[model samples]
Target: MSLRSSYYLPPQQLRAENLDSPLGLHTRNPQLSWKLRWNERGAAQATVRVVAAASCSALLNRDYLWDSGELRTDATEITYAGATLTSRQRVYWQVQVLDESNRITQWSEVTFFEMGLLTLEDWNSQATWLGNHGITVPLYRLSFHLDQVREDICTARLYSTGIGYYEPRLNGNKLGTQALAPEYTDYDKRIVYNTFDIEKQLCSGENVLGIILAGGYATRYQYGTPVFRAQLEILYHNGQQQLVDTASGPWLVSPGPWRDCDIFNGEWYDARLEQRGWDAPGFIAHEGIWQEVKPSNPCSSTDAPKGELVGTYAQTVEPPK
Candidate 1:
């Protein structure tokens, strides 16, 4: 990780940059009340708990606000949960101590933080699996890696078919399943998908994308079937689109008592295609057909060569939409 200083305050040494804020404050009331915010990876279903202690019990308050716009009155500890705050969100807190006359005595500085996001390692793992199985093949599939920027927004989306299932993570936090379906028959009916708007979960320079494809068969004969295929139509957000397809085989057939029967002998193939400089998108599949769409050119570069070991870690980055 790299560090960059945003602005330096004179009398009070404070620095603010990206999603991080390091500040120092001094007060004479023997109690310090302030709010801080930071980004968290994959905390979609958890709560943010804030605990504060002061030299005097009177310093604790019944009127402090802990990021979720709720009054902190029940106890010195405040918990924000059961809403957007529990999911991927940014929180800002404020502490105010009242004097003997019920007037505001002191105010603590404000800080910010983001929660529930993925990490670099998370993204790498997902990318590795996709790359190994030709899911990240350039022109064939829309190959993408995660990046961290100084933006105040983060989000993600997932889509699939055929009893699709997935475990999505942002930064390093697991965001839970985007889709869960048990039966898949037609191409359109078999699709499962999820999307997340996570602008609040983004960090300065660390982001991750973790995904699992759990709807494919485990037969030895179906080993080489391209169970997962994704294509990126446009590089930018405006024209960007994704096409995915998944399939399984031989679920009902069985071997005879005296002989081993190969119920599924044909191969299964999945492919995605994208032109480097052209807007023309392409795709091809050999399992079955859903709609009467134009078949992708088999000889096009979008298709990976058979038995070829595509190298991992080869990826390109584009600005987020």
Candidate 2:
């Protein structure tokens, strides 16, 4: 029997851009890597082949977006040099290896990485910062209707970040598994934006977007007000597109149940003060309770406490499984 049949296993722990199946990967040239498992210590790869496609089925069927044909090297990681990737594009890929004895191994398990907003212009031209200036812990909500389009929805992506930490909800459901995000950064330098796949959360019409912002990392010795921005892009089967954003939208903000919140001192919340169904559709707000948000300019203002918005590089910190 060959060494492949006796000792070698398929490449395990595949990663893209140093992340496992990452979403909203902003890099145009993401690197791919895998760990080899073999019984023999000196066993080494002689060649490698990487294949990528738009879908898993397409990848398995050899419908490639990019294929690095039989590279004569033992490198376990390679950078993607495929067709130009666009924003929100999901690419699936797998790898195969040839041993030093010319024995080929089975393909590695498929992994994927999604592209985020590629250009700075994509953000500057699209999103606007909306915040309640004086409120320490504010809940921002926007209710919008999605009319039936001619084509079916292909995908929907929501990109968001806050000067402080934020919890986002769509139609009363929390956005992603991550908490305490977008991850903390130097308020004077840059901000991390997180992307969520919200296609499954969306309904036919009357969708509600809600976010609760708290001073997680943006505050220390003194309290700091939080600001938030988000953009949702909907793509249809027919290549049609629609955008919903905090900018130029009728977004409302209200003080949340948290009377006082501090990183060191902790939060004080009253369940009796909660606004039921505020993050859901068809919830009528009590008179004078919610106020319109103010637009903040992060780009032009030097005194603003925020920074340049960029895609997050850190893996989401999830609760213990």
> Top lDDT: which candidate number?
2
lDDT value for model 1 = 0.26
- Candidate 2 per-residue lDDT over residues 50-149, each given as its tens digit: 9999999998678999999889998999999989899778999988887888777777888889988777677744566666457778888888766454
Residue 41 CA error for candidate 2 (Å)?
8.0
Q: Write model 1 residue lDDT over 101-142, tens digit each, in one string.
A: 222222344443333222222111121122122221111122
Relative to the true structure, candidate 1 reaches a TM of 0.24
Q: Please provide the root mean square deviation of candidate 1 (C-alpha atoms, Å).
A: 18.6
On TM-score, the candidate that comes out on top is: 2
